[model samples]
Target chain A: MHIYVTDHNGKEHELEALEGWRVMEVIRDWGLPIKAECGGACACATCHVFVDPDWQDKLHAASDEEEDMLDMVPDVEDNSRLSCQILMSEELDGLKVSLAPSAKPDAEVA
Target chain B: MSEQEIVTDVVIIGAGPVGLFAVFELGLLDIKCHLIDILDKPGGQCAELYPEKPIYDIPAFPEISGQELTDNLLKQAEPFGPTYHYNRMVNELEKQDKGDYLVKTDAGETFRCKVVVIAAGGGSFQPKRPPVPNIEDYENTSVFYAVRKMDDFRDHDIVIVGGGDSALDWTLNLAPLAKSLTLVHRRDSFRAHTDSVNKMRALVEEGKINFELGQIASLEGENGQISAVNIKNADGEKSLPATRLMPFFGLTMKLGPVANWGLNLHENLIEVDTEKFATSEEGIFAIGDINYYPGKLKLILSGFHEAALMAQAAKKIIHPDEKVVFQYTTSSTKLQKKLGVK
Candidate 1:
């Protein structure tokens, strides 16, 4: 499987992913500029992303725990979701998500 | 607030699980320690980020929550009588002329120690700033992350954002003082305590405050003075007259001031040797998730082993003339006595 992730600067990168693995792991394994601080535990909102509006319906709704974590994201949008909660599958191979500004590494903020 | 300097054998930089364990290891060697943490309590990320979350790989315990592990570690290190200084961050670290190291914090405290342990896990947790465009311009004037004094918000149209305890508690607290108060959140529901949420709902029922379901879109003001805060929601766009704005968006970790201490770092993690977990500088050590070595596993057990080895090395530096002895806590009566078992 593969996932399409857009960086904060709008640069798109196609990453090879494995089934059942988190979408966050795919983006981070490929050396993207993500701050997944809690390592996909949904403990932190550093992995926040904006799922493409077209692909929003294909994914399941955010769990209550995930929603609580999203409350930490300051710049969340209507399509916002934590990539860690999104699992890659054969049904949704090319899931497109744009990295939220809050998800970027703190060192790259400037 | 300059006070007398605190002299100790070792100064641990963090009060996390690993830092707390270091106190036990150092104590068995008859070395006293003083721990400093930025948080108001111990446990570091364990307490702050996931206090109730279960951890699976903590050696003996099959599944222990973050808070439980922290509590146990504190109990184990209690016999050492280590001092804990919370709510202060180490801002400056320099070697003194007398061979001891001088450590300074943002709270204006000074300490002299022979060994410095950099056990800070993932640096320090700081408030996450919202990505509102040009929000920086209004910081400290029209926008505030924390309320230092309630009088500063008196007579102003205050807009508090978020659904957490900080937002709801402040809304209920400052509502009586403000001319107009508005609570904005992305959703109508809140994650605060039931009592606080109920009080906030009562305030809304009394028409004493305004509740809006939306996120902050932008700020309106000039010269660091905000006039209004624009928000977007299901109904459409709306602007609230906000003389003061407070956003409680939780916290994120960043490699703070530790970067300026002139130590070798790899990807923001302190580089240390595997044998002693010592950093580039002598009398300084790095452990836990904050240190990096070849094939480092970053497990809690690995940090425990590092703490044991670092204690031995630290004991040598503090008392160079004394010959060190290796003893296990299980059979050695001397070690048992230090642990308060004998």
Candidate 2:
């Protein structure tokens, strides 16, 4: 399946991601700009990305923990989702996401 | 007597998997290093977040737990003899007149290094502060999440909170140092080591330290110096004299002091070039998740590769007179000898 990742700079990268692998894992395997710092533990908000609004309903809802972490992320939009929780499947092929502007500690983001 | 400033060829911040491997890479070139991390142990996120969690894709290791990987990295870096300074955060960085970097930590130690490797995975980890109004105002002076200097509390009235290892450990440690010491916890039970708990009970019985069964409700002090704290018990509210408050709540990750270092930041991560993994600042390289670049992959294997290239660049900065010769560990006898392989 081709998983499309729109980097922070708006460059689209078409990744041949395998099934059952997470969006974060596929993005990481392709060496995308996503940090995935906690390595899909959903602990760090580095993997937070904006799901294309058109495909937002196509993917499963974000987990409670992922939502909590997304809330911690700066510049969170209604389409925000943690890429780690987004598992890749054949049906979800062509899933597009734009990397969110990475968030720092709340005090330092300014 | 003036304290001798510790000097090294390179100072790598954050003793995670990448920093440990950097020690090995730099050690091959005879470059000495000293690594610093805020955590008490090495292996930043691996050992801290998911020690028992199994990690896949760690090249050559089909299946290995995070702790196992960290232990192996420690063993791998042992021959290099890189000094490890744990439980400290780098608070300041300054370019010295001699072109070396003058690095200072919260623990009051300084280092002069020709090259700086920032492997600080997700920046410094700090203890989660309890919810108290204006609690941030008392940090560093009267309230300390970490004990940087043991002597800082000498002859002072100290009150330790929480039921964890840190609280009990500090209670026993500071009892002899403080003019008066008191430990307060909501429950009678403790979550510390059995021996430390027994020692603390002994001290309580000996009248050396007071053990109050309650939670701190409010803090009272002025000018960042805490004088007293109100404790809420089952019976009533009581106040204790406390010149210093040591709360040992568990740690949480934050960008910490690294944000103020004046490095180019993509969000909280330092921007780096993939060629040398060097940050925007000259002679300062950032690898691992703490670094950001185009198509940056935050993985241990990626960090290892970055450490390799970073060491080569660092060697040039550390010893400009010597030429950097790239060699493979498989065929190079010099590399094998450095690895102590028979």
Candidate 3:
């Protein structure tokens, strides 16, 4: 399947993804910076991305825990999802996602 | 040869910031701990990745380097009676019939503890490299996924690959220290913060750093030293001389040896109880970066909170007869009072 990932820089890369792989895995395997701190178990929201408006219907509804995690994420929106929660499939062939800004603040150590 | 295992009050899987917090939490309850990690030193991944980089989000301290945080965490954990086994990886965890757990490491050592906490952060996700030829030969000698020490690159020519914050941030930080610094990215734009990108651009404009927008065609090095890096930029193929190649290309998380434990894992992360940080297994608990709990925040501060709560829950489970009274230390008590959590 084809997955289009828009990075934090607003650049998009169209890459081939395998069905059954989590969105976070596809992004990470393709060498994109999604963090996925909890590795897509719906734990940490670092892998959060916005799904394309058109393909949003293909994804499973976000769990309550995912909702809570999203609340803590900065710049959260109606389309926000922890990429680890979205599994790629034939139905999601044209999935489009944009990398969210990392919540980690600026460097303090000098 | 069934040798009796030496059991402890608790066993912590990693010695990073959260693991140290566990030590402190257990210490407050008069519980002894055995902490193990693969790094020769404490602080787990924080000490391994960006040890020189300053961290701003840690509570109280406005900013501290990874090394400093590790040092402070070690001091805090040590005072609480925790024994650390550095340079060891926990290869397996087996539950005993009596409800305790036995942890065996790759070093052939074993420890029995009532609770196990996995704080192995992004350390397990080794770096991912593009399909570039000749990159495998310099895995350790020159091409590196992590920066162990900053002084090691002093006065040397270095080439960094990646367009993200890690790559850009490191370039900006190391530009002044290295004799020559060249940054190559697959795309023109960067994923780093605007301020960082602006600073790097200023440096590049002043001829302090070289910014090459392109992909690495190949890597050339020999005898434990990287001599040059060849790249395919917008202008065509070009070769740049370098002493070391640091690829912040990004990390790929692996569950490592713990993947065999049969815990409910979502991809590479272990699922945990939202309230208690307990895993699907009764006595196994996860915290820090490797754990997944719905609605949980993933920051050092959030990890600290999770460690505190998990420690309390684990304590209650291990000592059912005892009443878990949280006696806040003076500092903690004062902070609690200020937050009005009375």
lDDT of 1 at B185: 95
The per-model DockQ list reads 0.52, 0.07, 0.06
TM-score of 1: 0.96
Task: Give the alpha carbon lDDT tens digit for every residue of B114-168 in model 1.
Answer: 9999999888887788888898898889899888899999999999999999999
| C-alpha local distance difference test of each model | 0.91, 0.82, 0.75
lDDT of 1 by residue, A63-94 (tens): 98998888989988889999999988998898
Q: Report residue A110 deviation for candidate 1 (angstroms).
A: 14
Which should have the higher lDDT, number 1 or number 2?
A: 1
TM of each candidate vs. truth: 0.96, 0.65, 0.53
Mark the regions of model 1 whose C-alpha exceeds 4 Å error after superposition. Answer: A107-110, B1-3
Per-residue error (Å), model 2, residue B281: 2.3
Worst 10 residues of 2 chain B by lDDT: B124-133
Per-residue CA lDDT of model 2 for B172-210, tens digit only, reads: 988998999999876676657789999999999999999
Q: What is the DockQ score of candidate 2, to 2 decimals? A: 0.07
Q: Which pairs of residues collide in candidate 3?
A: A69-B295, A109-B54, B125-B252
CAPRI category for model 3? incorrect
Better of 2 and 3 by DockQ: 2
**Candidate 3 error regions (>4 Å):** A1-110, B1-6, B123-253, B331-342
